[model samples]
Target chain A: MKPTNVRAKSLVPVARGGLLDRRSFILSGLAFSSSLAVSNAVASDKISTSKIDQSLPPWMKTPGNGDTEYGLPSKYENHIKRDVAEHTPETSIFSIWHTPIENQRGIITPNGLHFSVNHNGVPDIDPQKHKLMIHGLVDKPLTFDVESLLRYPMVSAINFLECAGNTAPNAVSLTPLDQTAQELFGQVSGAEWSGIPLKHILQEAGLKPTAKWVIVEGADGGSHARSIPISKLLDDAIIALYQNGERLRPSQGYPMRLFVPGWEGNANVKWLHRLEVTDKPAFTKDESGLYSDILDDGKIQRFSFHMDVKSVITRPSGKQVLPEKKGFYEISGLAWSGYGKIKQVEVSADGGKTWAIAHLDQPVLSKSLTRFYIPWQWNGNSTMLLSRATDEFGRVQPTRAHWRDKYASYSFNHYNAIQAWHISSDGVVENSYA
Target chain B: MPSRFLYPRCLKFMLSCLLLVTALGQVAAYADDATYTTDLGVALSPSEVSPYEITIFPSGKNLPEGKGSVKQGEGLYQNHCMMCHGEEGDEGPAARLKGSDGWFSFSDPLRVLRIDKYPILLISVGSLWPYATSIFDYIRRAMPHYAPKSLSNDEVYALTAYILYLNDLLAKESVLNEETILDISMPGKQRSVSAWPEIEL
Candidate 1:
C-alpha cells in the first residue's frame, strides 16, 4: 500500500542473487521524497515553465529583512514551547513545566525551554537586595552581593539536571494517545552554566575541618533548602549566575542558583541565598518526606543523588505519524547519565530481538546529554523500537520489571528504565512497553 | 647537537628557578605576617543575617526558646490551619495528618514490614517526616498559605504540638518547649535506611 519505487530503484541487483545495495540508502531516500513532491505538483496541476511566475514571493519581493538587536527562532518554530503541567490541583502554586525534548536538537536546552519546577511559586527577586551568605563552621563567615560575586573568578560547565519524579507517570501507566517522549521524560534538561565554583568561595571563607555538609537555602516563599555533602560541593558544584550566556530566567532562578552537577534537580537550590556549613545533614522536608524513596522492606533510601543510565528514542517516538510505511527512516534519541558519560547507545527495531550500535554524536561530555542516531529501513510490519544506553561506568539501563522488583511500585523517585515505542502497520508510532 | 643554545637554556632555567624561590620566600614571609590577598567575598557578621534565617537541624540544636500547650495549639489551628488542613488534621487540601490505615504501605499488601507499628500512610508532617525539628522549621518558614512567616515562635510551637497530639504521637496535656520537643521521637526516623545499593557498572 506504501510507495517502494524510490527504494526499489536505489538498490542495485546482483547477477547471481538479487541483493539490495546499502550505499547512500538514507541519502537517496530523502532526495527521492523531495523529487516526488515536486513531480506530484507538476503532474496534478499540469503547469509548465512559461506560465510560472518567476518573481520572488511577497516578502522576498521587497528588500532583504533588517536585523534586530536580539534574534529569535524562526516564525515557523512557534509550536516549540515548554509544556506546563499542574502537579497539584489544590493550586498552581506548585507546578512543573517540562522542556519539549521531542522538538529540541543537540545537547544544550535553550534558555526558554529549560524545565521549571516551582514549590509555592516563582518569586520575583530584586538582584539589588539579594546577597549570598556563607556561614556556620567557617573561619570567616562571608556575604557576597551580586556585584561582589561577579568579581570572583568564574567557570563554565555543561551538565544535565533531571527531576527525580520524571518517570512517575510511566511507572504507573503509559499510554500512547496522550503522552509523548517530551511529556513523559521532559523533566531533564542540559545547559552551559557560568558561575563561580562553590569550592572557590568555600576556600575564601576558610572551611573548618569539621564541616561535612552545606545547607543551601532558596529565597522563595517556602525558603526551600537542602543539605548537600561538602565533598559533592567541593567537587563540581557552582553558584550559577548565568545560563546559556544570559542572566538566568526568573523561573530558572533569576540572579543566582546553586548548580550541583549530575544531581537531582531539587538539590540545585534555586533563588539561592544562604549556605550554612555544618557537621550533619539537615534532613529537610523535601529530602525526607517528599523526594526520599521508600523500599519494599519499609526502609527509606535517603540522599540517592545520582540518576542512573537512561536513554529514550525521541524521533519516531510516541504520537508521531510516519509519512509512509516501508520508508527509510533515521532513529535518533538522547542518552544521559548522572554518574558519568554515555559510552554507547544500542537501538533495537524489533523489540530487543536484535540491536545495532547507534552512532554517538561528537563531543560527548560527562554528565551531559549525548545525541545518538541510527538509520533503518522499515519493513511495513508492526514492530517496537527501543534504545538502551550504557554509561562510562558500564551501568546499562535496566527493564521496568527489574527496577520494580528492587524498589516498590509506589516508590516514584529515581526511575530510569528503557523506554519502547511501538510502530503500527498504519505508520503510527506510539508509547509502548516491550 | 649545538652546545651554544644548551648553555643559555640551562642558565635561563636556573635563573628562573632562583627567581621562583625568591618569590616563594616573599609569599611565605607574607603568610607568617598573616597578610594575604585573595579577592572574593565580604565577611558576614551575625547581626547581618536576615530575621528569617532560622533553620532547625535534625539534632534540635536550633530550636528557639518557645513553649506552648496542646490546649493553646487547638485555638491556633481553628483560626489559621483548620480551613485547609481540615478538622482533626486528617482532612485537608494539602496532605492528611492523622489517617492510620495503610499509612506507610504503598503497595497492595497494605501493611508495613517494620516491627514498630507507627502508621505512616500519608506523607504528612507527623507521620512520614523523619526529623521532629522539620515541623518547627517548615511551619515557621512556610505555612498559612495566605500569610507565611506570620506566626510567632510560641504559636508555631503550639501548632506543632497540636498536630503531633492529633497523630497520637504526643500527649494531650504535654507542653512542647525547646528541650521537650527534641524528646518527641518521630516514627519515620526509626525506620530510616542509610545504605544505598552498590550499583556496579
Candidate 2:
C-alpha cells in the first residue's frame, strides 16, 4: 500500500493546568504523538479516508518530480547541520564538530553531518594517487591503490564510531545548565559503512603468526596513526571507502579509512594510507602521550579502546521548553553500547526514585544507536527526567556521582553516566548533575 | 498403535520415513553456496618495504640514519615550531610540552605531589613519553602542525633532541641519532605500558 501523510492529521489540543481529566488528557497534546493513535488506526485496517482529496498541495499539483541523479533532504530540514566546538581556534586542525543528534531521526547519521574530530585538519587527497601499503610482519608486503582495493571483495556493516573523548569535553565544568543534547553527546554517530574487509586483504598478504598489532596511519598533515590489536582488525575491521552509501567525505578520511566496528573513533584512522603488521604497538605520540589518561595516584591508563554503554534523553532535554505546564509529552531518547546491542532503556520521571521501561524500537543491531520512547504525563510541578541504559552484557548505566567516585580521580575519558534534566515550574528544562 | 486402517509396525515405519525426509529438507533449504573469496588486488615487491614503511618502534629497529644537536634544534624549533608550542614549549595554542616541576603546584598542591612521583601525567617529551624514538616518529608524522612531514630526517632528530633537552632529560651537547635515541631513558618509560592494562577507564 502507498504511504499517506499521517503527521498532517495527528494534531490535538494543548492540555494545561488542573482543567484536564484522564480521558480528555489521553486524547490531547502529547497523546496525539504517542503510539496509541497510530496503533488504533492500523488495527482498524481501513484506508485513511473512504473518499480521497482530489486536490494536491502546491508542488504535488503538477508532476510530482523531475528525475534527478542525486537526492537531497526536504527543504524543511535545513537546520540539521553539524555544530562546531572549537578547542583551539588559533588553528582549525585541533578542533571537533558534533553531530546534531536531537535533530536527527533513526540510527543512521547522515554523511554530511557525521561527527568529526581532526588533529591536523582534513586533507585534500587525490584518490588516484592514494595507496595503502602493508608491510612489516606480513609474509609479503603489498601496496593496494584505491582502485585495486575497491575491486577486492567488499562488505557492508552498520556500526557506530565514537571518540574516547566524546562526552569529556562537555564536562559539568565546561557546559552551562542550559546546554543542549547535541552539545553533550554529539561526538558519537552511526553509519552504514561499505568497504573491503581488512582481513581479506591481510590474508592475501599472508599475515605472520607473530604479528600481534596493526599500525594504521592517515594521509592528513598529522599523518595520524594508531596501533590496533590484530585480533580486532581481523575480526571486523573494514577499510571503509564509503559512508552511508557514497564516497567518504573529506573530513571523514575521504578515499580510505580504517573502520573498526566497536573501537574508539581515533583508532579507526581516517585518510588511511598505510598498515604495518607488527609484534608490538608503535607507541606513537598520540597513543603514548596524548590519549593516555593518568589517575589521581599517578598510575597511567592506556589504550582504553571500547566505548561503554551510554544513553541520553534527547527530546524535552536541556534548552527545550515544555510549551505548557501539565501538558502530556512523550519522553524519547537514544541509547548505544560499543560492546553490543542495548537490551533495555529505563526512563525515570522522578529522578532515581522510580523508573519505567521505555519501548526499544526494532532492528536493534549490535553497536548501533537504539531509539526508545515512553509516554510521560507532566503535573505542572518541578520534576527530574532521566534515562538509564543497559546493554546485552547486563551492564547498567551508572549515576554521575557513582561514576565520579570510581573514575573521576583517574581519568576524564569515557564519561557515560546517566544524564538528568530538570523541568522547572516555569516550563524551562535545564541540565542537572543530580 | 490402535489404528484400524493400518498395522502398528507399518505406521511406525511410515512416520520414521516422513521425519527423515523433513530433516533432510531443512538441511537442503538452509544450505548456501555463496563464495567468500575474490581474486582481486595486486601484491607488492620486497623493495617497497624500506621506502614506504616509516614507523619507528620503541626498539629503534627501523630508525633512519640522521643526527642533530640542541644548538641546531633550537634554530629549527624557532623557525618551525615556536609559534604554536610557545618559545619555552610550556604555554601553547596546543598541548604543553615542558616544565613538569611546577606544572600544577600553582593551581593545586595535590597535583604537585602526584607529578613529583610520576611526572608522565604532566605531558612533556621527557616526563610522560616512554620512548625517545616515539619523539622522532611523532615529529616526523604530525609536527610543525601546518607543514607536517616537511622536516628532513636530520631536522626531525634535532627537534626530538631539543624537546628532550628542554625537559632536562637530555644534555645540550648530546647529538641525537637513530643509534642513540633508543638508549635515551625517559623517567616515565618504566611505568608506561601500552595495550590497556586497566579494564575500567
Best by the DockQ measure: 2
Model 2, global lDDT = 0.75
Q: lDDT (CA) for every model shown?
A: 0.77, 0.75
Mark the 10 consecutive residues where model 1 chain A has the least summed lDDT: A13-22
Model 1 C-alpha lDDT per residue in residues B54-116, reported as the tens digit of each score: 889877877889899899999999999887676766444455555432234443242333212
Model 2 chain A: which ten-residue window has the lowest total lDDT? A13-22
Estimate, for each residue in A118-156, the C-alpha lDDT of model 2 and write its tens digit.
888888999999888888888877777787666655777
Question: What residue pairs clash in candidate 2, if any at all?
Answer: B120-B128
Model 2 alpha-carbon miss at residue A125, Å: 1.8
Question: What DockQ would candidate 1 receive versus the native complex?
Answer: 0.28
Candidate 1 scores a chain A TM-score of 0.88
Best-matching candidate per lDDT: 1
- Each candidate's interface RMSD, rounded to one decimal? 7.4, 5.3
